[model samples]
Each structure stands twice: as structure tokens, then as C-alpha cells.
Target: MAIIECSKMDKAINSLLSRQNYLVTQANDLARSFGNLTAFEHKVLDYCFSFVKAEDTSKQIYVVQMLDIIRHLGLNKSGKNYQRVAEAFQALNTKTALYLRTYKNGKNGIIMTSLFDYIEIIEDGKIEFQFSQKVAPYVFELKQNFYSFKLSELSNVRSKYALTLLKLWNANSMGKLNKATIKGTLEEWESWFLGSDNEGKPKRWSAGRFKQRVLSVSIDELGKLYPKNLFELTVEKSGRKVVGYRLDIIQPKLHCQIRHT
Candidate 1:
């Protein structure tokens, strides 16, 4: 017979964590800076934020079970899985997104913030981490611009571009968005997903090239993600040459559901 011992740190982490279903994250005018995360890295970051200790100002260690991560990522429990998870953190660790907050004077905006602090792999296939206090409010606090969806639902999204599209769509309030959706020029679409610099210049992706490379491919891949009716990806055309795109809300399964008894 064997007895399992739980350290005080483990106990503290367990006590701190809440079994929340949805992985909530936000991107307001102050926190919209992005460095372009891959599919795996993006989802893993969201999973960690799901357990962020909103009440703790000081660094709080939250334990995440490897099994849950593996299951969420659709990977079998194995050494390779462990390696992949570690790699995801390694990638996210170095990947920094700036948080820009305006001040009273608003003297030519330039205040940068780090999103993640550190990560540690622990015993029993569990991991620990701490996020910046500046990020806690936007993540856990309520905001008109908040974006949240199920942690499990995003596991199947493999296309980085499509997932990015979803994030940008949710970042905005879902009204003027319809106009943005309807008038989806490729230049605007690229800026939203890839983002722009302080001077307001985005990485180049011409409409024709983007259509041939990312646009059509991302739409198809997104269709394959869970909650089948994720979004109605419409490619607006002008006599065979792809002109623009329109992403219609199809009541994604993660966001909208009807209960049947």
C-alpha cells in the first residue's frame, strides 16, 4: 500500500483554483497588442488564463493537470504529449504581447506591458504559472468588450489564421461588426488578424495573394473545427476575382445552445 503526499504549495494551488468551464480572455483598446501566436500556443495560453487568480495581486501559482491539457488538445497521454505541452509553454514564454493603456495626457501612446510572468512544470504531470496583475482585470473583470468562449471548444482549431479571425471578430462589440463583416476587404482583414504597428502599418498581404494563400484555406479549416456551424464563411467575389469576405454568425455551438429536456 502507498500513500500520496500533497505539499503545501499543491494544497494552496488546489484551494485557489476554481473549476470554471469557459476560458475567458479580453482584448480592449489597452490590451490589443499581439505577436501572432500559433494554434497550440494560443489555445494553451487561454487554458492557463481560465485558472487565473483574479483576487490575487501578488503572484499566485495555479496548478493545471496535464491530462486536462492533453484531452483539451486532443493528444494522447504520452511522453510526446508532455514534450509538446512543454514546447507550447516554451513558445508562449518568449512570445510577448504588449498592453497599451492611455493616460490622462495621452501624450503619444507608448506604455508596454507583459502578459505572462513565468511557468513551471511540476510533479504528477501538473504545471504552474502566474500572469501579470495588469492583465487580471481585463481577463476576470467584466467589460463591454470582453471575449470569452469554451476552453474545450477551441481544441480542434488547427488553422492559425482562422482562429485569429475568430479572436478579432469577438474583440469588437457584435453590432458595428456586422458592417465590418459585410465590407470585409482583404487589407482590413489582414490588419485585424496580423495587427499593425504604432505607426498603423500592417504586414503586407494583397487581396489576390491572400485569397489564394490564407483566405480560402482558413475558411475551410474553420469549417472543420468543432461546433460545426462555427461561422458562415462567405467569400464575396467580383467576377471570379475574390474581392472580399463576410463572416456571418451561425450561432456557434460554444456560444449559443438550446437545452432540450
Candidate 2:
């Protein structure tokens, strides 16, 4: 057997150690953002967490019941007004409803304050929302690394990519996914713009024809390909007319080998 190399092993070990340190730092930052909580705040957060996690029936019934109990409980007995408790309930309802609406609306559903409330409730009594300073850095990092990708760049690609990304983001955030279910949505879009004979039976348009029309209207329009680029087109038959063609990207791969002595 050949002698082992210490230098390579040492470099690999150092790289792994650095990665571990980074993860620890990230976790500590998140924990700090949660911060210490007051006893009353702890109870409220616990109720919120339980309210969200319970079964559908439990959540539906207990959410209102718990709020009423908290409002009238001895903790707030000193103040008969129960203004804060009322405010918390209203805020919770509004935030939850708004989150549902946003989820329904797709990418447009993101709201900063609602997101804060969500984080607050999920953390329970362990972390206070006041110490959110530590969380902002991580949020900013996430935005930079992931959310910052331009939607406009995506819009130019086939709608399929845009629709797929929207579905993925929704599934990751809300545990539910909604995709455009209307069959031939993309095909219909293509026919509206590039179909050769509007009245005649819809003919399956080639990718080259689609690209040509796109370039003719505006060279800057999205999904335009070079004249020389190789593309494959498939047309589907419809009862009355040809539906439309699908365009795909293809690139040639080259392989090379080297012999070392």
C-alpha cells in the first residue's frame, strides 16, 4: 500500500470543522433572536402554539374558547378592560386570515408582519418577538440567497417553469400545493399569439415559427432563441384544430479522456 498523505487529510478536516462552526453560529443567532419571555407572554404563546397544532376540530373550537378564557382569566383581572387580550385575539385572527389569503394568491401572499406573528407563535414561550434583531440577519441572508431571484427573468422562460416554482414555494411554506389545472393553458397562450391562420383549423406551430413571431414583435421579448439553435417541436391533435407545439431545449455534450503516467 502507498503511504497516506497527511496534508490532504488535514485540509479536508479543516474544511469540515469550518462548516460545523458556521452551522453552530447560525443556530446560536436564531436562538438569540427568540430571547427570554415573560411568564404571561409564555402562556399566551403556548396557547397560540397549541391552537395551531391541534386537530382541525380542536383548532376550530379551542381557538375561540382559549381566547375567551385568556381574556377573562385572573392574569388580567387587575384590568377589567381586557384591552390587550382583545387586541391579541383580533391581531391573531387578522394575521391568520391574511396568511390564508396570501397563500391563495400565490407569490403575492408574503406579508412581513404576518410572517413575524407566525414566527412568534411557533417559537412558543422560548423566544420573544422583541429580540428579533438576531433573526433579521438570517432573514436577509435567506432573501439574498433564495428569494432574490428575479421573477422577470423567470417570466421570460416557458410558463411551466414559473408555475412549477410557484407550486414548489407554496408547498414548502404552507404544506399545500396548488398548480394551474387548466389543461392546454400554455398551448392556448401560444395559439393566441403565433397561430398562422386564426380562422383555419389551429395548426401546430413549430418552435422556430413561435420564436420568429416572438422576435418579430420584439427582439427583446422572452423565450427567443438564436436562429441557429437546435430545437424540437411536438404538436398535439385536437378535435377541431391542432392544439399547439411544445418547445424543448437541447445541447450537445462532448467527452474527452486523458491518460496520466
TM-score for each prediction? Answer: 0.62, 0.20
Model 2 Cα lDDT, one tens digit per residue, 43-140: 34334433332123211222234334444343544344254554454443332211111234332222222223333222121222321232334333
Worst 10 residues of 2 by lDDT: 27-36
lDDT of 1 by residue, 111-147 (tens): 3455666778876787887766666556554223344
True-structure RMSD for candidate 1: 15.6
TM-score for model 2? 0.20
TM-score, prediction 1: 0.62
Model 1 residue 133 CA deviation (Å) reads 1.8
Off by over 4 Å in 2: 1-38, 54-62, 66-68, 71-73, 76-81, 87-261
